[model samples]
Each structure stands twice: as C-alpha cells, then as structure tokens.
Target: MVKTTGFRVLWPACSLALCLLMLTGCPGPGDRMRFDETAQVSQQGDNVCFNITDARDYQPANMGINPRSTPSKEKNFNFSPGLTVADGKLCIPPSFYHFPDKGQFIIEYLLISKEYDEPRSFVITLEINGGHIYNVTPTEREISLPYCRYVMDNSVGTCQL
Candidate 1:
C-alpha cells in the first residue's frame, strides 16, 4: 500500500514534469508581440515636425505610457497618442524644430507600461539640431523604442536631413 501511494504521487509528478518540458519547446502566450519604433516627419514652413510611433499591439494589458520632464511646464509635451491606460500604445507627436543658436537639443522617448509598475521608467534620448531641446521620457512603467530617431526639414515639407 505504501509503495502504491508513492507510485501514484510520483506518476503525477512525472507527468507534470513531462508536460512542462513539452511546453518549453512551444511559444508562450506573451511571445507574439513585435515591439518597434516608427518615425513620421512632416514640414510646415520653417518649422519641422517629427512624429514617432511605437508599434507593438498584442497584449492589451501590457501597454501604457511613461513620464518625463521638460524645461517649460506650459509646453510640457506628453505622449502624442496620449496616455495608454485604456490603450497599449502611444504615438509621439512631432518635435518642432527651429534653427539652433548653439549646442544640441536632447529629446528623450520613454516607454511606460504596467509590466513593471514604477515611476520615471525607461528612457531613450533623441538629439535635435545640436541643442538639448526637449526631453520626453515616459512615466508609470518600462518601455522601449526600437526605432526612435528622425529629422524633418520644413523647407521642403519632408524629412531631408
């Protein structure tokens, strides 16, 4: 009777182990997402605008916006597509461009999500016109920008240089 009970317990354990091993070779439920960054630039007169979008839509529960800081509170820019508490992705608006007087402008792109709940999450920096202009980092959670750099020249209404 003791041996039979031990075998029964061991049988379930062995079956579970085999099932786990088989599952390891297959793709996970959360492994279907392909996160990447896309940049769209448009020019209006002397002002150049750059729009960056993050394309990763699979898990609705795994998407959101991060937070950041700026020099001007009145001009404090948030995610272009806005915060993603309801949605999982963010579309960053075009960063306006004016002739730089000196130095370089640094704009940061932050990815915010609930995967890791925290403040002031992941940061990606963008350099504009040799002046540290604007920084847009995400708040709330961690995110990434696979393709995040773009430049637009409004003199032609397109991204030239």
Candidate 2:
C-alpha cells in the first residue's frame, strides 16, 4: 500500500503554480512602470496627445492608450487607431465619453519598437482646470523618471549598461 502525505501532494501543486507564475511573468503589485519625462503632452482639439521629444532614439510599437477612473475600470472612447504619430509625436483623439474634472490614463508601448520585448508602460495622472491640463503628477515613486531610468539602466539582470 502506498501512502501519500499531504505535504507531498501540496509540494507538487505549489511547485507547478510557481513555475507557471514565472513563465507567464504575471505582473503583481510590485510591478512598476517606467516613466517618460521626454514625452510632450498637450490638449489638441478635444483630445489629449503625447509625443516623445529629445529622445529621438526610441520609437513605439504595439502602442495603445487606456483612459480610466481607477486601475481596474477602463473607460471607453470612440477613436480609430487609438494611437498615431503626427509630425513625430504620438497622439490620440479625444474620447466621446464625458471626463471628470481630472483624468488618468495609461499608455503602453514597446520602446525601440521591438515587438517581442516587454512593453514600457506608464500612467499619466492629470488635473484639468479651465479646460487645460493643469498638472501632470507621478502616481508613485517608482514611476518617476529618474528612478525608473536608474532601474532600467543599472539593474543587474535587466540592463547591461
């Protein structure tokens, strides 16, 4: 007769779960996004637009934008080709949905236009006053440009430079 201990059964299951988690690279609370200080943000017509200036070396791929009131809720808008580059800047049309006095959005893209690489993502938290962008604030410490740049360029396993 074979006896299976509870520990033995749980160990295999736990190991498999951990392997799956690593392989998927699932983002958790600790996952932090890199900020783009070089991005030029503005209100164009009824929409908000973005472009990366000074850093001509980086191009975006698989670029998309999501406007939201909170992390889990995605707001809808009517726009074809959600993101576009005009005169060297990435831009998006205004959402038909009504926005609050302030708005928050996320832009995700692959830096250097590398389709296979993990996308660089950031949150743009803004406060609108008198129909203009009054403030662009960092949501957290890690998403600040200086800190993110250090991590991306100096992290032992992530960057060779």
Candidate 3:
C-alpha cells in the first residue's frame, strides 16, 4: 500500500531530525549566554577579593559542560580567583587564577556537547576607593608573605587610586 510505504520513509526522517535537535540543541535568545566578563571583584579595607562568575552558556541545562573538572571540557569556565593586599598597591602576579572543579553531569542520560570553546574574557578596572593594588599569575611560587597573590601571570594588570 502506498500509505504504508510513505510511513516507512517518514518515520526514519522524523527520527533523524529529532536526533539533530538534541545534539545541536535549540537555545532561545535568552538561552544564549550574556556578557562574558572575566573577573568579578570587591574591595574590603586594605585587601580585595574576587571570584569568577558562572561560565555556563545559555544552552539547555543539559548543555552545560562540567567547567570545573580536570581534562574535562568544563574546565574552560575557570577564572582567576584574585586577591589584592598590601594596601591595593599591586595586581601581584599580573595574571588571573583559575580554580579547578570536579566535573559532574547533572543528568546521566544526556551527553555534553563535543565542543567547548574557551569562555568569554574581559579585564575590569575598579577605583580602589580605599587602597592600591595589582594583578598576579597562576604559577607564581607560594608566598611567604602574609598576603596572597597570583602566579604565572602574563600581563601587568593594574589598579587605580
């Protein structure tokens, strides 16, 4: 029967479309990630503390890659955990710190997208309202000084009075 034959072809086509949708995902406008700024900072007395914002894109909750695990695609969300002290006189290591996380998939039934491009990054300038400061890197040797700093930093990150 012609109707039966059409159903045979139609079934497979519909199934394939469904699979693609699941893979690429259908992110609505709000689903797309917003500004990807790098460091989020705050100042208290003579010291400043900052942490990276959530790096997950606006994709479906299932689409989020485990940004905190080692060798996992989600490590891409790592941001510098910067702290400034000694009177805000230095940005220290000059580079930002990236905190590592153990990746955990919220849903075992879903697969993370194969692609994990680096997250968006930006430099921020803050008026030191009460102190002086500088940036630091990730690989700098441990500090003997009471204050903390960054290591392997690549730039002369700055602070303002």
Candidate 4:
C-alpha cells in the first residue's frame, strides 16, 4: 500500500497550468497600466518646483520639456534639459516659468522597461493658472510594444498617498 498526500497531485496540476499560462500569456493592450512612477511638485510663492520621488524598476531616461501656451499661434517647443542625478535619481530643479493663466508644461521621458527590455515613453503634464498649479495629469498613453507596460505616474502634488 502506498500512502500519498494530496500535495503531490496538486503540485503537478498547478505546475502544468502555470507553464501553459506562462507560455501563452503575452502582455496585451488590455494589460493594466502600472502607475508606479511618482513625483513631487509644489508651488513656492508663484514658482513651481519638481522632483522625482520613486523610480524603482525604471531605467534612467532622457528628460524632455515641452512648454505650451493656450491661445497662442506659436507651436510648442521641445527641449532636453540637463537633469541632475542625486542619489542615482533624476531631478529637475525649479527653473521653468508658466503664465499666470493658460499654461501647460509637458514633461516627456523614455524609460527602458526592466522586464521586457524595451523603451516606454511617458508624458507628465502640469497645468498652471494664476500662480497656482492646478493639475498634474498623466496623458493618455498608447502601448505600442506588445511586451511593454503602460507605465505612468499620478500626482496632483497636493496630497500624499
């Protein structure tokens, strides 16, 4: 007579299922986006300051700053800023100025995916009005790569969660 626990039978079945799922489970457009990236933005006497809070599992990327003014015929201009690296984290000092009303600051960067080894682009927008920072929105991003994630950050910069 052989005495066997249920663990042996369940282990094989679970292993087989996991293997099949892994083989077939490729990242798709329906995959949930990971809003893990975070930043800190504050208004100091009509000046806005910005800093990156958490960048774990994200590769260092080139930072692009795009400033746009509403009701202006001039096209938006993009420029790459010299980002400061402190403690291996990227930081953008308070240097940009927005109008007292109707100004949009779009910060763009391409972070390399740690899991899929692909480049993922992100755009963080700061809407300013009347010496106040109103919204920090992560614009709707399209996931072009199959195995990459739609990684973006969410912060109004007024409260901590």
- Using Cα atoms with residue i matched to residue i, what is each candidate's TM-score against the true structure? 0.27, 0.44, 0.25, 0.40
What are the lDDT figures for the candidates, one per model?
0.37, 0.49, 0.33, 0.51
State, as a TM-score between 0 and 1, how close model 4 is to the true structure.
0.40
Candidate 4 lDDT, 1-161, residue by residue in tens: 13366777778999999999899896787575643233545555554555544444555456555574332244343343444434434445455433446677765566553566545454456777765675454433411223433343345322223
Comparing 3 and 4 on lDDT, the stronger one: 4
State the TM-score for model 1: 0.27
Error of 3 at 148 (Å): 41
Give candidate 1's error at residue 82 in angstroms: 27
Q: Report each candidate's C-alpha RMSD, comma-separated, in the order given.
A: 12.1, 8.8, 16.2, 11.0
lDDT of 2 by residue, 69-161 (tens): 445344332224345455766655554333455555544444454434443443444456657663244444414454332322111112123
Better of 3 and 4 by TM-score: 4
Mark the regions of model 4 whose C-alpha exceeds 4 Å error after superposition.
1-40, 44-47, 56-60, 68-80, 85-91, 94-102, 111-121, 141-161
lDDT of 1 by residue, 10-92 (tens): 99999998899897866776655444332233333444333433323322222222222333343333444333321333323
- Candidate order by TM-score, decreasing, is 2, 4, 1, 3
**Global Cα lDDT for candidate 2:** 0.49
| Candidate 3 TM-score over all chains jointly | 0.25
Best by lDDT: 4
